[model samples]
Target: MSEPKRMGRMGRRPGHGPGGGMMPGEKAKNFKGTVRKLIQYMGKYKIAILAVLTFAVASTAFGIAGPKILGQATTELFNGLVAKVSGTGEIDFGKIGRILLFLICVYAFSALCSFVQGWIMTGVTQKVCFRFREDISSKINRMPMKYFESRTVGEVLSRITNDVDTLGQGLNQSVTQLITSVATLIGILIMMLSISPVMTLIALVILPLSGILIGIVVKFSQKYFVAQQKYLGEINGQVEETFSGHNIVKAFNKEEDMLKEFHGTNDMLFQSAWKSQFLSGMMQPIMGFVGNLGYVAVAVAGGMLVVRGSIEVGEIQSFIQYVRQFTQPITQVAQVSNMLQSTAAAAERVFEFLGEEEEDLTAEHPVKLENMEGRVSFEHVQFGYRPDQVIIHDFNCQVKPGQTVAIVGPTGAGKTTMVKLLMRFYDVNQGSIQVDGHDLRDFNRSELRENFGMVLQDTWLFKGTIMENIRYGRLDATDEEVVAAAKAAHAHRFISTLPGGYEMELNEDASNVSQGQKQLLTIARAILADNPILILDEATSSVDTRTEERIQRAMNNLMKGRTSFVIAHRLSTIKDADVILVMKDGDIIEQGSHQELLAQHGFYAELYNSQFEAA
Candidate 1:
């Protein structure tokens, strides 16, 4: 079997490198820039973010005061016990009760603040995510067709779904955690310094060392995170391809091959994922160890101070709690680096798509199509899909108001490309196409496209009822008009036989109906559009002879007085055309009536004879 189509290089345009593998040492480039832009997206929600921050600070402050206040109760109980042991005083149960009640209130207030902060931030995160998705959706429409041609559907979809999700989760969880952690760190530090500056110094010294270690781990883990995201996109592309083309894979007995390829991609993703997680996982344990050492040092120093009566037992107790709280936030701060790395990687992909060059839709006083007569002309049209290599060079063609132009050629002979240019899907590199003597570039693209109707060999139908799918051609078309269009295209008979007729719902893939039925539905859609110019790209190629005859008759009626361009593979279909232009290697090698071409006995005659011989 032919080698499987190369799944292009991960994270780059296809066909550039030797083996389509990622370059070595490829980290998430320009991470800071990506992060800056991501922050800008959040800027719109500043008021909500400020409220979250206010609640977070309030919660952390209350929590920080609880440990110290609880220490006050400990001191009170200690003094009462000592006094009772000497038989000089009784325990003050009332004072102790009051302290306990106040502690309970402090903790309760902290909990409420935390909850409020979470609620506000969650809404903000979702809104930010919604805007990202909205912008990406709009960006997709603004992009030129070339962008979609280069990228897989899964790749683009992953940006909207997976990448956006990653950004949302990171912003929701990490941003709030970072804020709380920093706030807690500061509060703890102040409490520790007030109790014992020496102990605070001991705790502070360990932090720089922990920071150095965290930096080292993060340096290694970030590359893996970038690789993980890249491989995720690749795996998504693989799954999309395999599932969409499952029938072809089974017909060719390529299941094992597909599985092997999937496993290879899966393994790559697994390796990067675990490595990133493993390195990040190391942070907590390593910080815990350093924290234990700091704890021991502070404990030893505080004990000596207590024995010397330099500090109270209650202060030492509060200091130890502050030490633990401080270390935890440092650990959280370190983990935020990892979180930020993943966010940057995902955001970079999304921003890259949004930054793609869009087609220039701007026109100054653009010409509009009015009273269109369906006249089209190509004047020395030079064009190519790529600029370095021109495909259709110095081509010329013209047609009057009422004519059927048949384009026939072998595969890869630029028949489709020529029509695509006429539609302005791709502008010609070095020539002009005119509709009604007005340059195509002079008119608005939407207005230009509205005047032409197309039905291709590959029929596209969305997940909707048959009537709705036909109505897609003209959104405002009435139900009666849709039915009339379907009847005109000869689609009404078979559609009526279905259980719900025009109201039957199609699944996402539109697989409920047969291929011919789908083509007829598309034809009905074009019929409803009722444009002055029609494009039929192998409109009946996939149907059986009887269905082909019916479709051909419908097309003939549809093409009655309009200018139509028919690209056909079957020689028998276009025998009665007003003109047949035979194409070869992007140039029209022969042009005349079919009979005239047969009389010439050249490339056109040989192509016609081959079809007869094959039959």
Candidate 2:
């Protein structure tokens, strides 16, 4: 929930250890970090925690002590009544009635505490759940695009929903309940010894063997449950991949291929889940066997004592009740163990996600730019998605302030990588990127990103009003500013025709709207941002000629006096660029204005010719 950790490079690069290589997942066993993160949630609700513990302890005491009192009262009454029947004394029902009243009071108090436990824990758990989800959302937002590219949306959703909700019983209730149950067991054991030590020992002999069995089940279950959670994540990934690309599946007639992948994931999940559940399922029968054996011991030993006149009948009854109390809590404790492990596995994943590297926030203090000129330069910058396969090696380029620089390149020419580095989504492996003569790293990630606006090929809009989507560019934008930005992006006319004008609610991903409209909305966002620098990544690829021309006019108005970097396969869009860099295979092969490149008739000329020829 606290501001995410800033990018730290003092030690090794992230996702690595002291070995200077990728650390395997199981070897480090960093589950403690996960446990600590969860337990920290308890801090905010200290008063609720205290209240739950108090009620649980009080309830346990009544549950344990009340039975013993009733037992003594019965023993005394039966012995006294027997004497009276033999004409030795008179019966005392009044004393017995008081014992009955005491038992009723104890039951009432225990029930009330149980109610309090449920009520307080409900509030505590719901609050923790909300905080946990909110912190995760914030964490994900700050993570670089690398994280999302590496993980599917469904796998992420599992941690937020399934994994998080598992804590409801295990996290909030188990702590208090486990403590209370253990205390109750101890109290019962001590009281049983009072009636007859030999009997108590005989009754308890089965527990050690039971503990061994429980331990074995737990040890194996932890391994299997961890596997189960992992497989679930895999299955979630498969589902996300299939559904998100359902259109592609149908278009390419890949339903069978998709189904095969789904079946593989489904089978793995089943095996993992069944193995984990089978181990846990064994606990109940084993617990029942141990408990029933205790019953046999108590009956045999208590009968012996009675025959020897060592204890009265009622004392024997009290011991039986106490035996059930002690052993039944064991069953509850075992169940708690099972749930806690599952919850911990989920917590590990959730905390692991929250610990991802975030955008640098150290430069909370920034010098405001009074007059901005958008000059951008990359000097000997090297970068990659993976450590081994470098995408951009020793790349260099320069743009004068307020100049339009267009980059034309084949696929994987590092055209997109160049823009990504310029935006500082991923830091370069070598050299420096500078803006206005200052190193980009020195400006802080947030302050640096805020200086530029970007429009990508694919557009994303939330399920909200159209006005809300455009206003995302500047959260504090006025209604008039939003309308003006929309007009500049040539979006206002289409928006006005909608039933609700700018207030129309869009579907998920804005799928209901035309692709061009979505692009316009994204452009409106950029227009509203009005930053001194802009990067357009194939902004016109998804639009028609008419729409592109309209957006081009809007972009020209937006780019005046601001540096703009445009990456396009369509050469027409870059014709007016002051400088065009033609890249191939991670290297810049030519650099000049459009006419200058065409005159030389090299890589840029070929690339330009190919695009129009294909069309």
Best by lDDT: 1
For residues 66-117, what per-residue lDDT tens digits would candidate 1 score against the true structure?
9899888888888899899999897898998999999999999999999999
Lowest lDDT sum, 10 consecutive residues, model 2, at 1-10
In the range 43-64, model 2's lDDT, one tens digit per residue, is: 8888888898889888888878
The parts of candidate 2 lying over 4 Å away from their true place are 1-54, 76-91, 114-150, 153-164, 167-169, 208-286, 343-359, 363-367, 379-396
Error of 2 at 216 (Å): 8.4
TM-score of each: 0.88, 0.82
Between which residue pairs do clashes occur in model 2?
none
lDDT of each: 0.84, 0.79
After TM-score superposition, what is the CA distance of residue 562 in candidate 2 from its true location, in Å? 2.3
Kindly provide the TM-score of model 1 when superposed on the true structure, using C-alpha atoms.
0.88
Model 1 C-alpha lDDT versus the unseen true structure: 0.84
Clashes of each: 0, 0
606 Cα displacement, candidate 2 (Å): 0.7
